[model samples]
Target: MQTAQRKSLTMLRWMMVASLALPVALFLIAGYVSYGTTYEEADREIRRSLDVVHEHALKVFETIDRSLSEIDEIVRDLTDADIKAREQVLHARLRQLSDALPQLKSAWVFDAHGRPLVNSMLYPAPDMSFLDRDYFDAHVKESVGTFIGATLTPRSPYQGAAFFSISRRRQSDDGSFTGIIQTSVLPDYFEHFYARIGRAPGSYFALRRFDGLVLARFPVTERSAGPAPHDIPAMAADTDRLVTETSPLDAIERRVGYQRLAGYPVYVSAGLDTATIRNRWLGTMSRHLIFGIPATVLLIIFLTLARRRTEHFYVEAARRLEAEDALKHGQRMEALGQLTGGVAHDFNNLLTVIRASADLLRRPNLPDERRQRYIDAISDTVARASKLTSQLLAFARRQTLKPEVFDIGRSVVALRDMTKTLVGSRIEVVTSVPPEPCYVNADAGQFETALINMAVNARDAMAGQGLLSIAVAPASDLPTPVAPHHRPPLGYVAIAVQDTGIGIPQDQFSRIFEPFFTTKTIGHGTGLGLSQVFGFAKQSGGEIGVTSEVGRGATFTLYLPRVAPSHEPRSEAAGHAAPIGGRGMSVLVVEDNIDVGRSATEALAELGYLTTLVDNARDALEELVGGASRFDVVFTDVVMPGMTGLELAEEIRRLDLNIPVVLASGYSHVLAQQGTNGFELLRKPYSIEELSRVLHKVAPVPHHRAPPVAPNSEVR
Candidate 1:
């Protein structure tokens, strides 16, 4: 009963652990996946934005290129004096071009000596030296078709602020460079355009020259032109690629995409800040946690409450059942006590009459009539005593069975508790009756007496301490006979008694049920217990059979003709405390030597423990974590292959602290060097008695009916 309860609690523990752990594990994995997804999203967004910026910058640069071509065509074959003759017309043309484009600040026509001839800002051009400007210098050296220059800060009133320049060479008819037509492009134009695209957190846009100089950036920097961010080599080579780098302009890390402006020497960059991406991901996870955590908690709470409620119901049922068993056992023991007392009193009276009559008859020279009467009195007393003895036997359920329709299950269950009182407290008696009633037409008293007889025999075989299991079940027929015997065929209810004790020898099987035959020493046993059981089985039109091994335990089954249920067979329902004497404690035995291992396993079996034997520690652990049986203790050898017994003990504790370890060894350095470490230890060449004693101390007992001080003679 306790074993079942423990198993139930273990199942609940596993459920509780799964409820919390599955969610935690899921969230952890999801966190990693979501973070990566967010990064991918940022990369994609930046890439798309850079495409738009690429088209925008390409269109702006193309406009400047086209305007420069138009100016260059007008001034190409003209000398300085001829171009000065048409200055008004030229100025009006430059002004009209400048008016049409917001990005273009001013357009100018310069002479070969760098004297500005025509200008859009003024009718007469300023006296600026062409030798000083990068656009002018390149055009003069050779007939450069068009050139884009870095930003130039204004040094005169003609230039108001920093501006980039685009210029084309004004060549002669022979294609020699003479002068230049220049356009001043405002950097604020691109900056204002980027501002309209909107700022999202740390997002930014940049336009940089192919020479690694910034033309303009939004979230505008301290200066218009400076070295661009690190990773300029990758930026220059992979024009349409994405990269991650920190912006020197503001020291913000971003996932940036770069696209080179078509037909221009500059690249347009758009980036999504990493800080922004991380913030977005955190929000998503927070929402998930908000929903997930509560659901997990509620699940755990539900399981906990359900387990508690189930335990409460079990406790209440157990208490009621215990109360019923105690009352029933008390009543049976009292009735038997009264019967034994009355029988003994009647036998004493009969003996007194016989002794008195015999003594009178022995008197010498008595009268013949008197002598005859004395002899008759002795004879009558003797006959009466014989009759009284028969009555006693009948009361003890040894004479004749008065068959009646009664529930075999109920009879066994009732007698089972009293049987515990008859067997000593040292032996553990466990009962397993089918929940559905099993009925038969047999003497209820005789059946109970038969059950008690088997239990007493089991107790003696165990030397007072072992497991005695009484199980009742429906059977088709008796088990195959040890030696073939006529057994009533099929359709029987079987009552079985299994004992973990020194088993009977196979050679002695046939003689076990014969009258006056016994395995026990003289005076300790009367030898009629099994014979009586045999008689009862035969008289009731049933059969009794047994199976045994020399060192292991034995099983005896009594099969009776089954009585089909007419109605619900009577039900009676037990402070059957769990025994610490090791009854039903399962043990995992780890020993490498096969012979020694078998001997140890058999010994534990005799000591009333269910055991599993393994030659190595690996197998032992496999049994511990994976096996269906729940072990109460681990009994292992100290020196074995793979993991030592000490190591196995540690591992067992790590897996389940409730199960304890007991180390066994003849002698090993492993044991000598590192003591038992608080574990129980048994040395080699141990006796069966010592093994039983130690296991009784160490095992976690299951709850079952304890044995009584003595088995009543009526049962035997």
Candidate 2:
């Protein structure tokens, strides 16, 4: 047993360590994988921001290219040398042409003779010729390139601080050198373009033309100034090497994007400080984390709970295995019980023969001194055998009982006295019996055994040196009806045994009553004591309950039904006249088994009665109806093949009308309904005396109840 327990403990330890380590390792690996993925995603998000800034710079360059193309078309058309056609085209046409392009401030044609043909101003024209001007020379010499002049407020024609341009040698359909045309473009056009690029808050854009002029300054008004604040030459040169980079802006330690406009000689620096961008990202990321964190936490919590449930399943499996083992152990004890009960039954019959034979031997034929010695030996032997039978019945739980109403309080007080000897001097035994009688109808001997068993258990629990308490009172809480045949709210007697000892653990409490279940050393206990108590309580229609704490002590309480009225005890009819010598009354005994039928007939023959025995109920009925067998009483076993004894008894009542029928069986559960006449029942395993007594009680002669008459005085 110790080896088995050590093996169980070792398995449990390995299970516990596995239960703890496995989930921790798995979750740590999972968390590491998740953190790595999140970090990579954060890095990808930074790269995406760089791509957006690069795209914005390309948009700025496209705006400038579109504006330049519009102005070039107007200059090429103005050199047509059709002066009359230009004026007749109306000022509306000229204004429409100028407003058609956002970047070209105003446009007019000045012929090779140096006269203004059209202007995009209020009723005015600029007196200028681009025939020898540097813009004209540059345009004629280059024919396709734009040459932006110096960064100064323009003279005369379309004023308001602009940069002028020229285009010449425009060919008609005949390819003639018509004239040189000049136009001015405003810096506001570039300013408006930068505004469309849309800088971030507290940021700006700068557009630089190829000739080193800061064409526009967003968020700064400097229309009269020539060159802008920052060096445009270096910025424009960096156009090819203008990689978008995040750098600290100004004196403040903040991060922003700086990039040269793609496909053009201009610089666009539009960015927000790192703090501002971080604050915005932080708000968004905080909201994401707020949701993600709880979801992750909930997932972890669910995983932990699942782990706990797995542990519980293993624990439950162990408990079920223990329960199955306990069940097999109890079955073995029950088998032992059947064996002991069979032995006791046969031994009792032998003892009965010995006792009767011994009585018969003590006659006057033997010597007087020898007769006394033989009688003494027989008496001692019989007494010893009686003790042996008592032990057998205790083990088998099949003792004959004379249950009677008794006060449990009286019983507890007596037990307290007995426990003092059992528990020794070091242990204190206390008892509390209620003032009211806690009465139960149970066999006194078995009740004493139950009390002794509980006391012994308490003694063992205390390790020979603590207090044992026995309390007797009315049961407080009882279960409701478990079945239809339950008795009413009759009072119950509670016998509680409590010990200040090594207490039982909560998990092991249910197994304590199982037979052969023990936490004791070998040779110390047979493990039948509590099982006997359990069987006794069940046989007496009672319940047992237990309560315990780990280090504190334990208490077991037995609840038995309070004594109620029932059949009175049968007093032996000691002396009677020869039983009227049995005047040959016919008795029909019906039994299926031959041994039992022959036994009945032989026992009946000893009473000098005529008997007809049959093996089947159908034959018995036929014999009775044939008028050959006039039976005074028909004795039959209740359970038979052809028909039950009750059916045979019913048939006998219908045919013979007044014949008394006796029903006998090993089972008491098959008794007929009470108050049914013409039939009486007898339980099995009866002797001649029991048979004779039941026959006399159930089918007595009619004259047997008559009062005794004086023999001499007669009927007077």
Each model's lDDT comes to 0.74, 0.60
TM-score of each: 0.41, 0.35
**Reference-based lDDT, residue 657, model 1:** 53
Steric clash pairs (candidate 2): 255-274
lDDT by residue (11-108, candidate 2, tens digit) is 66665565556555645665566555543443344334435545644543344344445534655544434454655453455567667656556665
lDDT of 1 by residue, 1-716 (tens): 99998998998889889777867887999999999998888878787777777877887888888888888777776778988889999899999999899999889888778888898888776666757878877778776566888777765656576888888877777877677789999889988988887466767788887766677778787663443243243244464567777866577887778777655677788887888899989998999999988878886889867556657977999999999999999988976765565556566877888898888888899999999898778766765665444334432334434456777877777786788888888888888898987778776656776788798898888888888999999886666543232333337789989999999997899778754456676456545567667777776778888999987889999988887555545422101223234566676678888777777666656556666777898887877677424766678888888799989988877776567788877556655444566787765545555566566667646433222111111110
Q: Using alpha carbons, what is the TM-score of model 2?
A: 0.35
Stretches of candidate 2 off by over 4 Å are 1-471, 479-487, 497-508, 515-541, 548-555, 563-586, 607-610, 623-632, 646-662, 668-681, 702-716
Best by TM-score: 1
Question: How high is the lDDT of residue 646 in model 1?
Answer: 89
Error of 1 at 603 (Å): 99
By lDDT, the best candidate is: 1
